[model samples]
Target chain A: MSQFENVSVVKQANVYFDGKCISHSVQFADGTKKSVGVVLPATLTFNTGVPETMECVAGACRYKLKDGDWQSSRAGESFSIPGNSSFDIEVVGEPYHYVCHFG
Target chain B: MSQFENVSVVKQANVYFDGKCISHSVQFADGTKKSVGVVLPATLTFNTGVPETMECVAGACRYKLKDGDWQSSRAGESFSIPGNSSFDIEVVGEPYHYVCHFG
Candidate 1:
């Protein structure tokens, strides 16, 4: 869906990479937490504490997992990153919009 | 409150001024709309279509409404702008986080 319904959204944003990446936390009634975020034109490395699935909502990105080749993810696509791993994401031209689901 | 509960939030963000300002739209069941956003350290001008109340969630900014003196809004504080008017906001050091209430 284009939007999440019946959820709780935190007012403050989580800024990363000196504002190149910004996200707002969203909490579900069932205790599941997600984040809607955007990555502006930049290449950044991110480490994940928990297993995460990055679902692309708009724009596009090329991401690489540890020891893996870079792969593209566009709108309506998703990529998974294992817990305790790091990934590098590259965005250019347009900002990459995503919904990050955590487990 | 620090968060909005039982609301719908769009997945994508509204990027303005080449990503200097970013916001996500939140919808209430009552059909009211608000935005949770952050502005990176920069000076920017914004024009409002509807009256808006910008509630600071974190950081701070100095703002000047049309024909008004510059004023500061910090965390836990708020400032308002009239509809069809413009305002200048200056943020330094840190990104200014806000929840924008519309009327």
Candidate 2:
């Protein structure tokens, strides 16, 4: 039940991969932005525009960075992706919940 | 783009109906709670313990409240459901984005 307090959140969701992934953008008072999102049980590839740190809030995901081996990240775990790069993520059984930090 | 300011948002999403509908809980400074959510293209039934007002933020939905006729609610429109009641919503084409106010 971790939450982001005293922040601004966009009402509309960002739906990707035909709704397999959905996220809401939140902005802090200091102008930092992050996304709280979920990836349904599916394997998907995502391209990053800026550097991002994906923190698992609940559930789990197995991710593979560009030219890297697959690694599992569960609740309380995290993985980073370089800007202008891409990654593949596979979620099974349950949804993958995450907080994505942008830089 | 409409946004909620100075609020707390739950990091984990509320996934319902096998991920057909997803929402994030948001709490205001005064303790009021709402959910920003999206319903994918599907027909789903939802039961409520408390009264709720569903405000469409994007896309559209045709809803039937209990024994009422099906009605359309698009962006900027809202529909209310009585406490201890159930409603059926059908979304087609694009995902239906909404803000659900509970009381």
Candidate 3:
């Protein structure tokens, strides 16, 4: 821990998905909030009340925006999800790493 | 830059899997060799001439040894493969994060 003696910021996790995914909710010094999560392969659905931007940081995934078609998204690809709606994700062959921004 | 004022360590990557996974090869102050790789869902093979202790840091995976059964590995789990042999990894429904320690 002393290696990071100068780093006062420690990442904290707020949610865990059976080790398949982990969400670390970060609150910046100015109190802005963002969540970074690592998602493994699987078909999972999420309901949101706040608009969110999901950024694929590592792997790939196909997401269906409510009644929308499943679109292909690769690493570094991103999509937006509306508030009061839900989205479905089909994790592809590899782990799908992502960061979600919410307001 | 000033955020990690106490952290002198900077992660460097020697391999990148199309941004699906990234490996940060860490060389300790004592000259130890280890590779930390985040693997997105994929079926990949690796050949190693040195012994490695593959530790799952985040996700899960199934690895098959030489003529061995496909064993399930989850988060915080690990398996060792002999030197000079190759192994197959079928990344399941998530990212397979790993830390490989070598001599």
The models' CA-based lDDT, in order, is 0.98, 0.98, 0.63
Clashes found in each candidate (C-alpha, N, C closer than 3 A): 0, 0, 11
lDDT of 3 by residue, B55-88 (tens): 7766688999888999988766789999999888
lDDT tens readout by residue for model 1, A1-103: 8999999999999999999999999999999999999999999999999999999999999999999999999999999999999999999999999999998
CAPRI class of candidate 2: high
Residue A69 miss distance in model 2 (angstroms): 0.3
Per-residue lDDT over B17-68 for candidate 2, one digit per residue giving the tens place of the 0 to 100 score: 9899999999999999999999999999999999999999999999999999
Tens-place lDDT per residue, model 3, A2-103, is: 111122222223334444455544344455555556666678888988999997766788899998998988766789999999998888666776667796
1 or 3, greater by TM-score: 1
True lDDT of residue A76, candidate 3:
65
Candidate 2 vs. true structure, TM-score: 0.99
DockQ, candidate 1, comes to 0.96
